[model samples]
Target chain A: SQQGEEDPQALSIQEGENATMNCSYKTSINNLQWYRQNSGRGLVHLILIRSNEREKHSGRLRVTLDTSKKSSSLLITASRAADTASYFCATVGFYNQGGKLIFGQGTELSVKP
Target chain B: EPEVTQTPSHQVTQMGQEVILRCVPISNHLYFYWYRQILGQKVEFLVSFYNNEISEKSEIFDDQFSVERPDGSNFTLKIRSTKLEDSAMYFCASSEMGGSSNQPQHFGDGTRLSIL
Candidate 1:
């Protein structure tokens, strides 16, 4: 897998079911962020987790980071139809001077209501 | 809510022509960035700017590309002598802080550039 690679490129689930997406990177990162993008639209920041953090939560979204493995998972609980969008994990590498975000290919999620 | 707005949502320019894309970041943002996504490709960073100078730029930002905060309010990306490969969706983003990467960046809807 490449740096900032998200598995399960496409995911479809029932409206009320939980959706889980995973991402992996090959380098040390200062922080990682998840973003949502509807088709032909801009990216919307969802959450961020720092290097030292293990777990973080906001609303129905839960993110977990494991520096030892350079992996992270995002879980959207009780997902709604409106939650359907492409989800991408972006990393700010420790050595990135300008804080540029290195993004993954993204997971295209579909919540069937 | 404060938003980063981009002008000329869609642009079509002839090859070898100079083209400029404009962005107005959120009022209080301190750091500004530009990223581009070729159709069906992942978003790629182009440049980051702060305090009127480019802080960092990717290899993709070649000599043909330039950025300017020409006025206090507008940040522009000018591509001198546009090429067909330059046709992509360009996004402008801003963040409140520059010291840390933990701040979430807000992005504009993007300006789609098409070169003929």
Candidate 2:
């Protein structure tokens, strides 16, 4: 089974709008993390929420994890054109070796000026 | 800020040849990892190393693939015999610690491997 899967494969928004991306996983996890990637670049860590934590915020980014539902959401507020990139949710769990991550396919977000 | 560094932004290799990708993780990091992503695909874990040995590896890390920390500063992934499917952007990452510590990983830009 795929460990992580993201929805709304693509999103287009104007600058200043909020962008929300959802991700679901197949099993229990120790922690869930969000990452962003610009075209052809490596991933940049955004935020992480442990199974015990419900929500976390970093600057303009917010992340919420629902263990019961095995789902998570990432919200980018007041987005800018520079924020255009792909966002992914990854998990660490029994299926994943310690420190190893299982990643979602990612949602491509485009913020137009 | 310190960053993980990967060598050769891009590499082209003939199928059946061996290839080695190198990374220099952050100086204080205790855990090291390698991951790959084919074009437009999710990043997949390849293996994780700590204390100079592999602690965990995915199925994709078969006999053909091996990792080593030859020195205090360098970590490497070597594919004995590359295949067309081996082509992908390989990234190296590291963190101060692992598990419940909730340490987010830092990554290198990536090394794009193209197999011919």
Against the true structure, what is each candidate's TM-score?
A: 0.97, 0.97
Give me the displacement of residue B112 in model 2, in angstroms: 0.3
- Provide the DockQ value for model 1: 0.70
lDDT of 1 at B110: 96
Which portions of model 1 miss their true places by more than 4 Å?
B99-101
How far is A60's C-alpha from truth in model 1 (Å)?
A: 0.6
lDDT of 2 at B98: 85
Top candidate by lDDT? 1
The digit string of per-residue lDDT tens for model 1 on A1-113 reads: 23667989999999999999999998998899999999888999999999999999999999999999999999999999999999999988887756788889899999999
Per residue, candidate 2 scores C-alpha lDDT tens digits across B1-116 of 99999998999999999999999999999999999999878899999998888999989999999999999999999999999999999999999988657889999999999999
Provide the interface RMSD of candidate 1 in angstroms, 1 decimal place.
1.3
Report the C-alpha displacement of residue B64, candidate 2, in angstroms: 0.7
Worst ten in a row by lDDT for model 2 chain B: B95-104
Q: Pairs clashing in candidate 2?
A: none
How would you encode candidate 2's per-residue C-alpha lDDT over A1-113 as one tens digit per residue? 54757988999999999999999999878889999999999899999899899999999999998888999999999999999999999988844546788899999999999
Model 1 lDDT per residue over B1-116, tens place: 99999988999999999999999999899899999999988889899999999999989999999999988889999999999999999999999876264789999999999999
